[model samples]
Target: MRVIVDHPGWTPASEPRRTVRTENSAWTATAGATLILNRVGEGRDQAPAVDTYSPMDLGGSIPENLRSALEEQGPVQRLRTADLWEALATAIIRQVIRADQARLMYHRFCDAHGAPLPEAGPSAFPRPETVLALDEDDFAGLGMAFKRRPLIAAAGAFIESGTKWAELPADVLVEEVQAVPRIGPWTAGATLADVTGDFSLYPYGDMAVRKWAAHASPDIDWPTDEGTFARWWRSFAATPEQLSALTVLTLALGGPRGQDQPPS
Candidate 1:
């Protein structure tokens, strides 16, 4: 099975799906699915394709007011990283930087130290242990700041704690991660959403979300409170995180198709 992931910054080896992309390029991991099989010690035996979520899956769950805005956009699909460490590390790298800059650095980091996926052409992002072992001088010219060292330390701590870190509940994960020197709500929330498929976590400090959510749903009254937002989502049996994605897609592509997710 061929896997192609287009989400920028997610490394290849850990990609849950077979596909992966860099800052500006997409690559097919021809043997990615096979690798998943190998990891689980399963022989190739005609496994079924994974069922993915689509906008149509939302159905009546969409709020009435924002439906039109979201309906006009291009294809949007929910994407997840291959693992918790990948999600957490990627979030840390993206903090307070322009996306293009961050993605370019991420590409460089992966290219230099990522593990070889011999069956596929591209390499996977280095594991937390590998990242922790890299010398500070090696990070030179990669556009990383001094703070990246501590970020790696935090990731190492999380990774070394074994299943304990992975098992952290959503709220607890947020609290624990935010305790890291430079990690914040936006980083932690984004990690939980990507790693755990927790769509209820809206990364609160994002400026784009603030602007888009306000513009797309004016009826709710902007800046009312978290409770108001929570209440709004409950009415549609949806989540602020989900609505945030919808709002972003609507703002970005004008609208999404009936069958595609918006801003996932």
Candidate 2:
């Protein structure tokens, strides 16, 4: 829930903004709603406003045919993180690794570097410069693999690129992420989906996603190729991001393996 703002004239004070900081708080957003604040800080009234994100518009973009199914699966919403750098870092950790293991390392990374805010739940993931400051030994202590080459390399490349994720289109974001060495389509696609909040691009390299698609919708001929999957995803649902969430349902419901638990 840590919120980071990167605009020239704005900031979120390096912490997550919560409508309800605690369960006992009086303030509460309506059920199944994401509240977005356009501006923050003591004098945000004078600062240039950040672009507003509306979930209402996001929901409307979904194809009618998939509405029922999406709803049946559960309420789905996009959460805008302070920065995509954490997403990119976690994606790198997940490359060719098991989810549980990757998750452990991800948490460890956050714990090692995150700066705890006064009331925010957990510390926000450290900034890119904080990560870049660490050496191999420091990263290795956090249970990272490959001497943390992929993470450090990717962080360096992303930092050098100087691209503002808020401004990049899906395609350009894909290209930008993929340009980094050792970061392929799967890594790039996952990063783009997270950073840009665009799930149209399928993670072709994700075995779980492919397995889910094969079992969830056997009627449709799913292709292993990334390009083909992108076409099917776009045509099937205007908001392919929903498909990403649906796949989680499929996985939870037992995908091609036909069991609640995914294959080890």
Per-residue CA lDDT of candidate 2, range 12-105, in tens? 2233232211111212111123335432212212221222222232335444434444344443333433356666775676666666566456
Per lDDT, the best of the predicted structures is 1
lDDT of the candidates, in the order given: 0.53, 0.49
TM-score to true structure, per model: 0.65, 0.62
Worst 10 residues of 1 by lDDT: 255-264
Least accurate 10 contiguous residues by lDDT in model 2: 1-10
Which stretches of model 1 miss by more than 4 angstroms? 1-6, 10-65, 211-264
Off by over 4 Å in 2: 1-71, 163-167, 214-264
lDDT of 1: 0.53
Looking at model 1, the pairs that clash are 3-18, 3-19, 4-19, 5-19, 5-20, 72-255, 72-256, 73-255, 73-256
